[model samples]
Target: MTFRQKNKITVLGHDIKAGENCELSFGVANLHTSSSVDVPVIIERSKKPGPVVLFTAGIHGDEVNGVEIIRQIIAKGINKPKAGTIICIPIINVFGFINLNREFPDGRDLNRVFPGTKNGSLASRVAYKLVNEVIPDVDFIMDFHTGGAGRFNAPQIRIAKNNPKLDKLADVFGSPFVLYSKNIKKSFRNTCHKLDIPILLFEGGKSFHIDDQVTNTAVNGAKRVLNHLGMLSTRFKISKPKKMPVYILDSRWQRASFSGMFKPSIAINSKVTKGDVIGNITDPYGKFNHFVKASNSGYIINVNESPIVYQGDALFHITTKLK
Candidate 1:
């Protein structure tokens, strides 16, 4: 929660002093066509020295909703802080983004390769550059993400359990839900945690889709966090969340009982009771219809939006315990 007062900071080998704004290129590799791909890193610093907060999204190329959140943050000038430095990397997996795919061109999941080696795979090289060149000077990070594979996640802030500092920060972010999640091995969140850099992983909406409600929720949360840190500009107004976030201690996915056309009757963030019919599965031939009942009484944090689902596929993510 504390940051050393820095007069000058270097990012991507470029030195930027206080009260300066810079846009640096994080070009990792070229496309198969040999075209250049440069990831833009937008930065803004204040005259006063304070914390350096990094806002990142598009770790998975298909998670366009996350990219949109960062896009709005920059387009609305929200990245211009009143104190400290605000760094925005709206898209990270440019290769996947370019191909409209989730993984890098070489089929490696970028999130799985962290603290990478210099002479590794394409995804690993990007991860290496990010962990080595960028993360060293970061005080905190807010990594945006969206649900994958036709699943829609409710807007939520995810963090490891039992960190008071992260808990307070998550409260300040004020999303609809705060789900306690463990960091994945070799993931960006895990690397940051190992480096002692606190981070909040935000998951919302669905891949390749953008919802206004989800975007607004994340943007507002970011603004609130900036305000809490005394980095928000006076020109921006912060709105309080309608209700306090639900702290989810444990959750489970309710899988589909039958494979067929699927439709969710309950929406994300909706609370349900045990045995409630939250969704249904039906065959295309109208021979059978199966009502998907809730496994237990809890909030629906994620819903599978895919029309056709298979048996044992995750249909709904329901909370099991609350803090």
Candidate 2:
């Protein structure tokens, strides 16, 4: 976990020296109306030398909870480090963010396109610029994210298993749960891994929604990591996690048995026994009501909040095994 000290770092073609604070534009394209889009890249550096950390969010655009966590970090002056450089990109997909959609105008998931071609689609080109320009000097990254659609994910950190470096960092992040997941092909996490940059992928709450508790947990985790790296400013106080995180090794989705209105009786992060009633699916006329039972005794990490569901829609994400 030791980082080589950097006195001068170049980001997006800007040569930033020690103790310099700069805000640069990450603009790639303009809107249909020809208006320019500004993606601000905020960089804060300390006179003392330490590791360079990057905080990024809004890869999906609709994941406002992640955006909020970074926003609070910037607003509270958390990005001003004590002995290193901190970079913050609060929103990455400005196109999707402007349209209030999850994908780009070209219908591409920004997260799926990594190390893209210079002349490829809009998403691909942006990915290429990020990989080639901003990421070359970053030592570590913390990309914030949230569950898709109506699924609410409990506060958690996701990392590829068996990497002791990632395992120790995930523990330092101190989220309530740590899930081991494989890196998807061409994903941002995979790209960072290929470049040998350590990253911690955080998931919590739901897209387009922000919970105070979730925000607090993520913010505190960021503080703890910065403190660990000797980069956090002395003005901030680090709070120990109330409890140790649950490490999930395997998990399964509990799908709906019948198509109808759905309500979850069990909350997220709740541990349940096998055959316990966790939710119920019923028709609008009340003619039939089927109670959903837990398939195994484990924790409920994600709960789908959609009112209407199909017969096979994922209703709950329950842990099948733990470490």
Q: Write the per-residue lDDT of candidate 1 for residues 174-218, one digit (tens) a residue.
A: 999999999999999999999999999999999989999999999
Steric clash pairs (candidate 1): none
User: lDDT values of the candidates?
Assistant: 0.94, 0.95
Error of 2 at 32 (Å): 0.8
- Give me candidate 2's TM-score against the actual structure: 0.99
**Model 2: runs farther than 4 Å from truth?**
none
TM, every model: 0.99, 0.99
Give the clash count for model 2. Answer: 0
lDDT score for candidate 1 against the true structure = 0.94
